[model samples]
Target: MSAPKPSKRPIRSYVIRSGRLTDSQRRALDEHWQDYVIDYEPSALDWNALYPQQQPLTVEIGFGMGDSLLAMASAQSDCNFLGIEVHRPGVGKLMHGAHQAELTNLKLMCHDAVEVLEHCFEKESIDRVLVFFPDPWHKKRHHKRRIIQPAFVSLISSKLKTGACLHLATDWQPYAEHMLEVLEQEPTLINHCGPGKFWDEPERPATKFEQRGKRLGHGVWDLLFRKE
Candidate 1:
């Protein structure tokens, strides 16, 4: 008898919403993309080659409209920042913002973050990773599509250096709890906020999405875990 094959992992963590792009955003894609964008390939990226100096590398996943990411990168000149987002408009907007700010410490990838972690980032190459306000996928059946699963956390843990951090934020209570459960179960990660606790709001500026969520009375939760 033939051996059983391994089951294929799910490829999607988010569903792209249909939001029309402004002309400026589209124009940025054409004119400024080469300056700020990193083309995704199925090969490991060299962090030292990508930036001028060998400083700490931080990557933010799903940076919606990139307001907070732009602010953080602008404030932190010594550390290099890379962002991965599936939305073309967000990528273009961030590119434009980074260019306008004259920021040299930032780069971007327009692709699924999971694939990027699996292929483009070598093991223990990342110093810090951020996942802020990811889609909650609120429906019970769609919960499987949420990104904070054991396998996903494990993959992130593999890419983080020892003592490096993984920071996650969510406005949805259930998803935040789920994230806590998932991260705690990963033996390679230790909670910086203590076991089963959430962190205070991070120093980064708030994205438009987060601001809107806050205006509606939704509470936000942040989780910071270090690689053990």
Candidate 2:
């Protein structure tokens, strides 16, 4: 008899870290989950029913600790924000903040962002997609685990509405170059800063990761691409 074949493990962009949750984060997760969190489903979400009123929708992938996302939601009351994060603590913190602020335009999902984007969101339905400070997966052999690849960029581009923007930011210079190369190859997107140039004047609020990187003297790169 032939030997049993080894099963292939799928490559994922993120690895869940065993970060301990604070008391408030735990409490929020247990009590306020239904108020601010959405259960992931394979079907496309109905935005009309999700938000209180019709507004431009922005989806943020991997909102670490929810600081930047919370700030954005609070600042941009006119836009609806949907944040996808796999970490439970981050979701809980964001929920706590949103509940405290009585925010009506913010929702969250604790799931794989790639699956969420591919299954829950309809093509040409999103106004903007933000991926800020994603894990670089720095090792050469682990480059396949990076999220900013050609296929993922194409997927993002397909989901964006015409004239909508896809904004990506990274502190790692090598990862930024990788992102630029992948994004430029996507036919559906046009770089807002012109070819092979990074966005010099970023209007988005600074993230906690960005601040930390800046203090360490790391250069940051922002790439803004618009869907055609």
Candidate 3:
């Protein structure tokens, strides 16, 4: 008899860290989840049913601790926001904040962003996509695990509406260069700051992590690309 074949493990951009949840975070997850969280399903989401009013959609991937996302949602009442994160504590914190603020324009999903984008969102459905400080995967061998690859960028481009924007920020220069290269290679996306250049102005409010990085003397690179 032939030996059993080994099952292939999928390459993931992030490893699930065992971050302990505080009491409030746990309680928020248990109590307010249904109010602000969207369970992931392998089907396109009906935005009209999800939000009370029809508005432009902005999706933020990997919103660590959700501080920046919450700020944006609070500030941009005209736009609807969907945040994707795998961390339970972050999701809970965001939900807790959303509930306290009575934010009707925000929702969240706890799932792998790549799968969510592929399955739950329709093509040309997103008005804006934000990817801020994703895991750098700094090791050379782990570069393949970085989310800013050609295929991923192409997928993002397809999901964006015509003239819609993709904003990416990274503290790692190497990863920033990699992102710029990958995004530039996508034929459907045009760099909003011109070719081979980064955004000079701060387009969004700084996240807690970003502020901490800045305090540590880290330089940030921002890239803005639009779907053609």
- Per-residue lDDT tens digits for candidate 1, residues 1-228, read 999998796659977877788898988899988888999999997877988767999999999899999999989998999999999889888888898898889999998999999999889999999999999989999998888899999999999999999999999999999999999999999999888899985766777878999999999999999999
Q: How many clashing pairs per prediction, in order? A: 0, 0, 0
The best-first sequence of candidates by lDDT reads: 2, 3, 1
Q: What's model 3's TM-score?
A: 0.96
| Residue ranges of candidate 2 with Cα displaced over 4 Å | 1-6
Runs with alpha carbons beyond 4 Å of true place in candidate 3: 1-7
Q: Per-residue lDDT for 102-195 in model 3, tens only? A: 9999999999999999999889999999999999998999999998889889988899999999999998999999999999999999999999
Tell me the lDDT of candidate 1.
Answer: 0.91
**Compared to the true structure, candidate 2 yields what TM-score?**
0.97
Can you write out model 2's per-residue Cα lDDT over 1-228, one digit (the tens) per residue?
999998797689988988899999999999989888899998898876898979999999999888999999999999999999998888888998998999999999999998999999889999999999999998999999999989889998898999999999999999999999999999999999999999999879999899999999999999999999
